[model samples]
Target chain A: MKFNHACKLILKNLFLIFILTSGVHGNENVNDKVKKLTLELRCMTCQNQSIYDSDADFSIDIKKLVKQKFHEGKTESEIKKFLVERYGEYILFRPLINFKNLFLWLFPFTILAIVTVFLIFSARKK
Target chain B: MKRIIVISPLIILFIICLFTLFYIIGNKDPNKPPSALLNKNLPSFTSKSLFDNEIILTDNDLRNKKIIINFFASWCTPCKVEHPLFFELAEQYPDLYILGFNHKDAAKDAKNYLKDEGNPYTFVGVDKDGLIALDFGVFGLPETFLINEKGKIVYKYMGPLTDKIIKDEIQPRL
Candidate 1:
């Protein structure tokens, strides 16, 4: 009976150690994920600074919230969508490629295509 | 093909000029970025009252009433500029529910500021760490939101309310 009690206590300690070490490693990855996600977020209080770059209270709170959301198993796009929904598209420095922004994204390429077509015709004429 | 090429540049220039004129004539103010929460349901929150810690106010309590949510801080000078307007608003619209959020200010300081200025709010909720403001997407202090009876955030104004704004923009909504 005495030996069985000691073995049970030993198993509990081993389980606790496993959880503690795993939690520490999980936290390291969580920080890295938080950094990457926050770099994409604008600090609403400071207005042009990235959340990762600003030391403002608003930025700090956002960083914590992002970290918490990541821990809650939210994906990067999910987090971005959530922030965009709350703060609007102005918060995203890199605009999404939606139908509204499709024109914005394709404009330069369209200009280049037009220029290329014009140049090819002019060269053929010469 | 040669004529098409010659006309394409003119077409491009015309489109550019058209968009530029549209932007200019649209009267878009660069200073004010439009609020995302417009026409959206109010974000839920349960906050302790500034005057009484035991007293709590939640999003549900605001339903079926026209609410004016004003985020203010004692440290914000612009909030001070719009301070007296709340009093006038309360008087004119007795049925309107004015929910004041004491945002990020020390509790004592918020109390003192309200005491000095006179509390025009129906209920003052303390947003001590600014989490509530974050949920509301409050970019800065002195941001005001008008909620309709259904608890949808119908309009949001991000600056001090002038008498002109109150008369023209706000009174009509009320």
Candidate 2:
């Protein structure tokens, strides 16, 4: 009897957590989501302008695309992936953290680790 | 131990300097980065032909045949510079299909431009809203693509095509 109650409680808590997290994600206005995603995308026509900031034809089209994707119930990452596939990595301001770009992402941390090790070694010597 | 420690960062810096120098020395134009769609399949598209009111062109029409797709606008001045070259391309390779996409251009203006320039394209499609260019990841006006029999985009050029480019870059591929 006790085990059955415990199992029921765990299932109920899990369901609640899932609902809360999904609600938070879904409650954001579609326009706000579009703005946030477009901020990360580059305006291909204009030099050094994010899609959200640029009034270029390319930016406007991307904004329309993102809005459409959101309306189709696509997630942010899904939309980003679609954009990356369509336009290549140049369309993104932030490079993706994949095997090809793993070195780029970890290079700063590698430097930090080396500096820390060198500092510790010198301190010990002193 | 102290010498080795001091030399390590110097070694790393020297390696970095060498790589950076090699990259800078390579003939990479700062203005033009490489197109990302090289060797990729052309995006499937459908459009109404500029010449005919009822004719529609789709990706299926491009199957088992090599086609050169050129995106141009009547309003773009640079397109006029490359305008004459298509006639040459059409003349040289009679079997090769040349497609013209009149991007974001009015039907009347495109018809007038073609009439004035002497139409060389096998088919002219109307991309009235620039959506087709967006699909191709076109950065600016007057982009050209060479699609192979496999429907892969083998070569892409941004800006106007010159006689030299046609001889050196495009002819050898054909």
Candidate 3:
């Protein structure tokens, strides 16, 4: 009985050590991930300011939340999608190509098409 | 006749461009008119002064004081550039209470920043959470808000405050 109790105590201590060490290691990973992602997300309310730029209390809270989400094993895409869902694509200062934003997507091509047609017509006229 | 027609279009375009430039210049006054929030009371929120631990600043605390509230952060490069301008304002307006709301900074870093850079604020407060900034509708760093003695915000200026702002607009208004 005495030997068994001693073995159990040792196992508990080892388990505690593993938990503490892994918790710290996990926290560092989450912090790194959050910092990396934040550098990309623009603060929509602040023109030309990245999420990392303004020290607004909310931005810091978001940074902390991002770290927490990362620790939950969310992928970068998942994290970005979550922010978009909450704040809309406005949170991403860089506009993305989509059906709703089809004009934004189509604009360059539309301009090219117009230029090409004009060139062809002009050449034919000449 | 062809030259006259071509030259007229170019002159018209040049005039249009010149008119547009003047329009932009007129509208670009950093000290925005008080119309944004003429009679609105100040948004109530709480923050700790980055300079002193004992001083806790709240919206209610600003009542009956001509206050210049500046939002800034240690990491923001432009904030550093605008710091001198802020100092100039503080020096000029002794009665004007300059409050530095340090958003999203560790208290230690804020204290250190004050130590390194001359502390211009009458009180430096830490917006550790950023709730205060949101209440004031702060979307950017280095944004300054002018609040009247009654605690109503008279104007808000986005981006860095410049010498022209101090001399031409703010000083004249005061």
Candidate 4:
């Protein structure tokens, strides 16, 4: 029983070690970076889904381009800026906080502030 | 004071209603996504000509002339609808260059479609992998971009071209 248990434990460790070492090398780092960038990019075809979550042809092309750009030594920001320059700010899953979209970004916070002020005044009245 | 407070919300609602009405009345085609390439220089790309694979077309080829870049695919139904309009425009304005960027389509099918529909394009480039369409930020097929002689994109139309669009929007610019 002890020999059988020891053999099973050895096999499990060997399997894990094999899996870990196999993926630790090569372009895995770049792939992770590409995945992170793709997650933030809105899939233009789907409109509502991120490229990472979409299987649309455009999303697939964008992912390939992202990985290729990374391989070409472009930084994440450069890739994002390139995409934004072509696709506009709409391609970002999060709307860019710019002068044009300032109201869009601030509206929720502004509403919260107004509600808080109203609550405080109502509490005082009570 | 209580009456004033009660009336304030009603006034606000009235203003909101007025604003909504104004927006609905003022804007046409509210569903059209704003083109990012408007007023921007054409995105540069190189691709093989759809008609002749040996011929390459670059951004420079599209410059020095007022051109209409139409994104189309043989599979897109709207493109077929707009096909005759392009032919009409091509004949009406011989100086105006109509370049077709075949998006995400097989080369053979694109050739066949053009053959059947009557090719109006001065040059057709195959965007087989859709990288060129991506450069143009094209979300849908049958999107048209009008580039001025200087190679800057002046206008974009998102859907099938109608006679009204040609007369009202494109004719004035041309």
Top candidate, metric TM-score: 1
* Model 3: DockQ score: 0.08
TM-score of each model, in listed order: 0.86, 0.84, 0.51, 0.80
Please give the ranking of all candidate structures by TM-score, highest first, separated by commas: 1, 2, 4, 3
C-alpha lDDT of residue A35 in model 4 = 88
Deviation in angstroms for B161 in model 3?
A: 0.6
**Candidate 3 error regions (>4 Å):** A1-126, B1-39
Candidate scoring better on lDDT of 1 and 4? 1
Which of the two, 2 or 3, has more TM-score?
2
How high is the TM-score of chain A in each model?
A: 0.81, 0.73, 0.68, 0.74
lDDT of 2: 0.86
**DockQ of candidate 2 against the true complex:** 0.28
Model 4 C-alpha lDDT versus the unseen true structure:
0.86
In order of the candidates, what TM-score does chain B achieve?
Answer: 0.91, 0.91, 0.76, 0.86
Best-to-worst order by lDDT is 1, 2, 4, 3
DockQ of 1: 0.46
Candidate 1 off by > 4 Å: A1-21, B1-5, B17-31
Off by over 4 Å in 2: A1-28, A122-126, B1-5, B17-31
**lDDT per residue as tens, model 4, A1-126:** 999999999999999998887767547898899889999998877857899999987788899999999989999989988989888777887877789888667756765665576567668767
Query: What's the C-alpha lDDT at position B59 in model 4?
Result: 93
Alpha-carbon deviation at A17 in model 1, angstroms: 7.4
Per-candidate interface DockQ score: 0.46, 0.28, 0.08, 0.37
- Please give, for residues B1-174, the per-residue lDDT of candidate 4 as tens digits: 965764565466567657757865676543465787899999999989987889999998776899999999999999999999998999899999999999989888999999999999999988988888888988788899999888889889988999999899898888
Error of 4 at A41 (Å): 2.1
lDDT of 3 by residue, A1-126 (tens): 999999999999999999999999988877778778898887655555778776765577667667777878899889887666434465676666678788657756765665576567658766
